[model samples]
Target: MTRFSLNQWTTRHWPMPDLLAGCAAAGVDVGLWREPVAEYGLTRTAKLVQEHGLTVTSLCRAGFFQRPDALEDNRRAIEETAALGAPVLCLVSGGLPEGSRDVDGARSRVADLLAELAPYAGEHGVQLALEPLHPMYCSDRCVVSTLAQALDMAAPFSPTQVGVMVDTYHLWWDPAVWDGIARAGAEDRIALFQVADWVTPLPEGVLTGRGMLGDGCVELRRFREAVDATGYTGPIEVEIFNDELWAMPGPAALDLALSRFAQHVV
Candidate 1:
């Protein structure tokens, strides 16, 4: 029986205290986020999680490696993740910085940064999970936009220090997606598995318009089966960024997510 968690993006309008309470009310055991915890102060946020008994699945992000000035920023991200007691810290190798069009250069910089931070993350018992964003976001979002690419980038580091996140919304269209999932699991490199549906013609490519589970065409069960085949039984985290959902109340949005997770993902 796999557990289900909700990403904070689903309830971004709610305060940290309310988010934790909402997750608890919905019977969600895990929560994921990017910089929200730090913005709210780790001590206060961690205390809230303790009071509500919620698990921090993975910090939403920690990488923007394309920037030349990213080394110190990456170090601080690792430190913050450790302080939050998050088992995994997600990374999105940023797009090319201004005045640059070299994708390979950006990737190389990401590799270098990962090499520098891997030991520190391992020492703190936090795994770095690289998330592959959709290709449409190639220019402004993550450079590693495919499961294969993310796995390749993470190959040099030990699984304890660097791993990959398999988000169905970003990867369901890849021809080699199943293979990548298998490889990640075979190598024990899948740090987290996130779920969301892919809607065509994204509005802005930055935020909003993520479909709910079973609302789009992604083969959710097939993905779950594939991941399960690889012997990866971690929680299946639901992450949706939709304007419609955001407009609704937090509890309503969470109820829909949980029901859909039960109906479509099992």
Candidate 2:
């Protein structure tokens, strides 16, 4: 059976210690965010995970090629992931820089930035996992918004050092998603798999409007089956970003996530 994990953003406001304790108690692996890990102190956070016998599935993100300090920041992120014993560092390539509408140029920067970081990440035994956010975020958040695009961006690098992330919430609407997953599998580029359902009437920014599993139209189990068919044996991370979920008590949210994950994903 495929294993299930929870991304920390699903309960964004949850305190780190409490969240870690909850996941340990529930025997669930967790996807961590850089901010909280930094705020809580990197060494402390790693020790906490070790003490609880918890697994850090992957670090949230470390990409924004447009930023002047992007490379340095990513180097720190790579070190952090190594400290946490996480194998993947998710990358959300930033959109076209201010006043720039050249999408192709921005994507080229993504590839170039990966070339610089891939070797460093590999040195640390971490994979740079490029995540394609929803196209709605193409303008300001992530320029890479499709599995194909992410895979292509990761193509030139070694698969062990650079790979694509498959998040159901982002790729659910694409008709070619199944084929994309197959290509990712065949290319050995699936660095991570995230689960989130789709919901309409998106909020002003559409950042936190993800639907809980089974509450929307996504064929969650089908996506899970597709990923499994690819021979991936890693954690299936639930990463809902709905406001309601973030408002619940962390434990309550976690319990609900576990139940929904069992029902709709695996």
Candidate 3:
């Protein structure tokens, strides 16, 4: 369980305190989201995690560069991540601005913004982890849609200040993923590795359709092996986004994720 971290969204409904206690009892770490942390009170949440002896693997996100407040928001996120003692801050680069078709421009904006924010992250002792969402979300969710692209964006920054996130759910279809993983390791650019399977007939509002481990066509173990080969000895966070899974009680969902992670991810 040393490398298994439960991403909070996998059991979205779990109350913060219970989630911390349960993860502590299960002997696993956690990946937290900003909203939930805010709701539970960041300082209090930090104290609780410390009390329970659970590590905060990474803080889930601060990007969306297209937004006007992106800079300030991301700075705050870096501070929050530091407060939680998380080493990485996941970033989801937002898509094109309203009525904009300049894909290249949007991608450029991400690079520019990362340059400005990476230093701030470094100052706060946090690594800005750029995440490449699936291309299907290109227009509205994330402009950075490939692991290679994410890597390129991080190239200008120091590895400790900026890195790319490797998520199976987003990069599974990329034939270059294995090579990308290798390159990331060689460059010391892999900040976090997240696991979630992709399923067909993606549900409407596809954001929440991520499958539990082993439930889809993703070569779960193969991906794990490839990542391990990269010399990355970091947490493999389970970040499934399924409604059905969310409906289950928190403990039940955690149990299922743990079981599947052991069977399919390990």
Candidate 4:
């Protein structure tokens, strides 16, 4: 059976305890998040997750190499992810810093940061999953904006040390998406498989406004077929960041998302 998980961003309006409870009530098996855990405190959040038997699928973030001062922060994020018992830590390469328009330079900085963080993450049994944001977000969100680019950066690290996060919402429109998935699997580099629909006329950059499953133009099954062909049997995590969805009760949104995921992504 395909396992279903929710991204914390989708339930940002709800408190962590309520979110976990709602996920359990909705029958979701796993969950992902960014820094909200720290706000709620790791020990308390971990206990809440345990109480509901929810799997912390992966931490939402742990990378922002654009700044010269990012190394320490990245390391701390890796340590926190390990403490959460998350098998994977998702990394967003971050945007250009002030007075820097060089995308290549940003990429280089990110590569350097990853090289420094990989060994530490490996020691903690946490895999760093570099998430390539959609090209639309290249300016303010992430410089690593494609699976091909992410794979190139990941080439030097082992799958356990570094890997790729294949988010359908980010990569669905890429012409090389399937090929990238194949290559990631061939190299054993796929660390996570995130799902969400792509709605047109995106309001802002790519952060929020993601569509619910089956609500947009993404070809979900094709993505599943590609991942399955690569021998990846991990949970298919649903990571929508829709504002409207967040306003509703967590259980209602989770139930609807799960139904859409089964009908569209399975």
The candidate that wins on TM-score is: 3
The best candidate in terms of lDDT: 3
lDDT of 2 by residue, 39-97 (tens): 99999999999999999999988999888899999999999999999999999999889
- In candidate 4, list every pair of residues with a backbone clash: none
Per-residue CA lDDT of model 1 for 46-153, tens digit only, reads 788878877778777778887666788877777777776778888888888887888888888888889999999988899999889989778887889999988898
Alpha-carbon local distance difference test for all models: 0.84, 0.92, 0.94, 0.85
**Residue-level lDDT tens digits of model 3 in 119-177:** 89989999999999999999998999998888888999999999999999999999999
Per-prediction TM-score: 0.95, 0.98, 0.99, 0.95
Which candidate, 3 or 4, would have the higher TM-score against the true structure?
3
Q: Provide the lDDT at 69 for model 4.
A: 69
Report model 2's TM-score to 2 decimal places.
0.98
Candidate 2 has which clashing residue pairs, if any? none
Using lDDT, rank the candidates from best to worst: 3, 2, 4, 1
- Model 1: weakest 10-residue lDDT segment is 26-35
Candidate 4, residue 173: the lDDT equals 87
> Model 1, which residues run further than 4 Å from truth?
none
Query: Between candidates 1 and 2, which one is better according to lDDT?
Result: 2
